[model samples]
Target: MIFPTQYSMLSTEALKSYLEEAYGLNNLGCKLLIHNVSDTYLLAGVDDKYIFKLYRDSHRKLDEIKAEVELLNILKENGAKISYPVTDLKGGQIQSFNAAEGIRNGVLFSFAEGKPTHDYYDSRLQTIGREMAHIHNITADIELQNPRKVYDVRTTLIQPLEYIKSEFTELPEEYAWLQSTTEKVVEKIRHFDLSKFSYGYCHYDFLPHNFHFDEHDNITFFDFDFAGKGLLANDMMTFYVHFFFQVMLKKQSQEEADKNFQTFISAYRQVRAVSEEELAAIPYLGFAFWVFFLEFYQLHFEDWSNTFYNLRFKKERMGWIRNWVEWYCRF
Candidate 1:
């Protein structure tokens, strides 16, 4: 018997054959695009293209996967520009594969046209803001049959620290700093009038890399894997993270970053109402974003990217968090 395998890479050829049969496509080509928590594949045909994402059971269970599909369908129906899932001939949106580790789920999405752009000119910033607001308009207060993850203090701040404590055994000072900073963020958020905050489903990872801009300058957002129920401000906070990195890397000055972000905020306000208080809460919310991903990286180290999560990465990540706190947070 094959030794109990924890993770397995599905054969690209087998997947191509299976998808051709499953979707009734001809002359298809399948190649691995990314091998992260969930595996991504690029499927090309003579006339069209599609993205196939295979979810790891450990990363996203079937229920959560269904929730993601359901959310995408709703967004598509409501005219949000997203790379929605394609249905098979049998009217099924999800495909189940029996792998060495057990059953894995996959979905085929209409390929988002064009490429991701790093430069956020005024037009692109406006487009990003409007598009994000469009999504928020649809996702706000929406309910799904299957539940996705919920972002809150417990899940994003407290639990992440708990999950990553063991990894910081050798660097107790860093861990302690994280702990104290998390407490400060939690307290600050608690003091806010959260009842006035816009409540909704959020694409919690709204970074530039998750979207593409076509030649026509139209945007198509994809990779809703980390979407969940949370404050709508969480989405804005995530987008702000893009600017934070730009400033951190010295690609742009703080003034340029803030100006760009303000441009996005202005465009967003044209579509939806955002409270000043919610805007003020971004720093605290951004802290949770970093901490949550730190735990995610630590948790998925073995299967996600073992080499990328070594001691050096941990120290670098800690530095990032510290910088975030110092630059953004008062306490």
Candidate 2:
């Protein structure tokens, strides 16, 4: 049987039992944090805290999950402030259990203190840019123990078009236009000069929400579930589009978004040199990211009757996609 987000909820008592028995932690309270791609639970412990992430069996393969664990460890060793995975009593990083949806996997992580935000000052954005570059520089030489999915056109573009077409026999009038636009974007970016571009594992979802900052203005990035091998420029584009969306959502002007983008890119350039050729390919990559992001949500959540998933809301979301894609594609 399918479950919501392909995972089951754990009671506080059950969570405590699991932690005490396997991970050897005192879970004073367990609260379901968020359910986006996975069911993340906040496991409160005595004098400390931790995050319990239950992987949706259908979301990622075992190897990919293992890769994520290893990636985090490498980043931590290399001086990135990452929330590393905690091993169980059996000295295993992953724990599998049968849920209604089927057998699912879970991992424990040390809670990274501080709250994430969509807004940040120039100094904070500068810090984020440098920190992200540090991640790329450090992980450039480290090899993963297990393989993870590589971000590319087939995984991000064409497959999404096919999935949407197959899933819905009748779609909005603009759906066809979206498909063709995605195809054009794919064709345009099919041949890019990788010599000037940096390619490595990315936080893929390197947005403001996935990060938090302490009082010293130090930032910590979490939720690397979407992390994988891809163009570093794509990560930068993803960051741009997210802030751009915020601009649209808040009814702010493009001028504000432009400033934010420049602030981010300028700071990023200081840490990692981005050539004109690679930076030129960023717009189309942003468009492709728009498609992949949309497909990710649509494919995962089939039902849209909820307030945020209603027909009108879906249309509004598509509108944002259309506008954002056009906005960047124009330049």
Candidate 3:
């Protein structure tokens, strides 16, 4: 389904062979344990750790990955606890390899030990909020060269609409509704004055899966593959839309949703206060995120539906967009 290139290409035997060749482990009695996280490859051995990210799409460039590594290195240098990119003995930021499938570009990194933030307490959310603010503060002054813009709501919606219209046939009724809804949302988004919002480099996708928390409640952010220049409000809104709206609010009552939103916003505002104007923009951003979700799901639905595990959840996958649009209009 969501098979990343590295995971699909490198099997257990292949990993062992590669490690044995790369690290001269032929004589040494060691085993390579490969961890298959969604969309990335991670391997752990007796005394070594490495993360391998496969270049699945052409949207990301090698230079952009280098920029992300530099940004993380800078964050670590500034006292933020993060996984630093590991260089080979010959000193290189990134290592390139040619597999039979395609060019697999990757950077090795030492693993940062922690669990995902979902297992942590609500107090830990406050700590995460503060730490995220600190990260933003540190990065605000550092100017990046030729940074690409992360995929936003507008592009996410429009691109897929064109794709579905051109490629897909025998349209399902629900998909037809999605297409119509996207057009309406696009009109609303275009009317909004986006120039009034503040823009900066941000971690475009900050979900619980992308963050880690230690025993002491220290939060470390990771997965900068989607990081880029964008509106800070949209960045924050993306997190809210993913965690609260999609995960929690969808399953619970409106009262529960409002409570959780207040908690997150309160904690976030303690470090950086969002203005009234930005607060008003949250609903529109939420609507945009709905479009984004629909587009992403439409692109991946076929592959995902074919997978054994993902097939079970296929029916519920793209149903949230309608409720999201309704909520946005009411708000």
Candidate 4:
């Protein structure tokens, strides 16, 4: 399968060759499945199920991969209802392959049995809350051997502003708005004390897409690519901000949005209750989180030439930012 952009370093032939060579399979029935334009993921059908994830860029280091493997294994050992990395017969979790293209890393994982929860399920939400809380509880005491770097909100906001001013001058209106809004956001973030919040190993990137729901509505979380040491509130804000943008913003009525938001918050609070101070900080951090994702897409757009960021989705995200900023200012 050809990758969508030039930045993607992995080629189909290279990946296939590496897999065949690594597993010593003469002929393996492998099909490319769920290639997220940003990352190449393949689901090869072996005697059992296995997933091969090919890193598209060099931004991720081997150490990060090892941390994820170790963290997942730890969670699995603690009975967290999450999938762990599959080991080869030799009992190796990671396999390094040197192909002509580059040294790409790949890992195998047992096929997690479940579907993504598209709509809200109370039990599933409760389970997710409890599981996430349990994960935090387990990792809170254990020091991260290789903690990933913290994502700076100010840096995230500034990069896009610079890019728009230096690179894309065509969309004058959008660029102007982005610049002004980024300035205001930067000002707001400067006064906020993020260090005061509780810090620990957070999922960092939990969304409906990353979760799997079994027939019994049990949610199993996956894809710990962005897992690292960060503020617990930051992780919660990230998840809430995404859900607000993707689900709440689309609702036609205020009641509908409020109801959905309450359900999510209620479920979340049940497992890990947020303090009043944390609740107050949500509006600010929520805006900061939106800025992070906004810049995240901008970084992708600049790095990957063929990326389509879904303009409508971005507009909705900006709406969330504007509303949160307004709400915070009033309070």
lDDT tens per residue, model 2, 1-331? 3544534565657767877688776546878877667778887756888898888767877888999999998888888977888878788888887676677788888788888876677998888878888888866666788987778888878877776664344455767877778877877786666755788888888877788888787788888998888887777877887778777777557787778777877887887777777777878877777667666766667322232544565577678778767777742
Query: Which has the better TM-score: candidate 3, or candidate 4?
Result: 4
Candidate 1 backbone collisions, by pair: none
lDDT of 4 by residue, 10-32 (tens): 56666666666665544545556
* Per-residue error (Å), model 1, residue 220: 0.4
lDDT for model 3: 0.61
- Residue 302 lDDT in model 4? 51
Regions more than 4 Å wrong, model 4: 1-28, 36-47, 190-195, 246-249, 302-305, 309-331
- Candidate 2's C-alpha runs over 4 A off are 1-7, 167-169, 250-252, 302-310
Weakest 10 consecutive residues, lDDT, candidate 4? 1-10
Give model 2's TM-score versus the native structure. 0.89
Off by over 4 Å in 1: none
What lDDT tens digits, residue by residue, belong to model 1 across residues 1-331? 7778888999999999999999999898999999888899999988989999999999999999999999999999999999999999999999999899899999999999999988789999999999899899898858999989999999999999999999899889999999989989999999999999998889999998999999999999999999999999999999988888999999999999999999999999999999999999999999999999989998898998687987898899889888888998875
lDDT of each: 0.93, 0.76, 0.61, 0.63
Question: Which pairs clash inside model 4?
Answer: none
Using TM-score as the measure, which candidate wins? 1
Q: Taking the candidates one at a time, how many backbone clashes does each contain?
A: 0, 1, 0, 0
Query: What TM-score goes with each of the models?
Result: 0.98, 0.89, 0.76, 0.78
Per-residue CA lDDT of model 3 for 188-232, tens digit only, reads 656667676656677767777777777877676777776777667
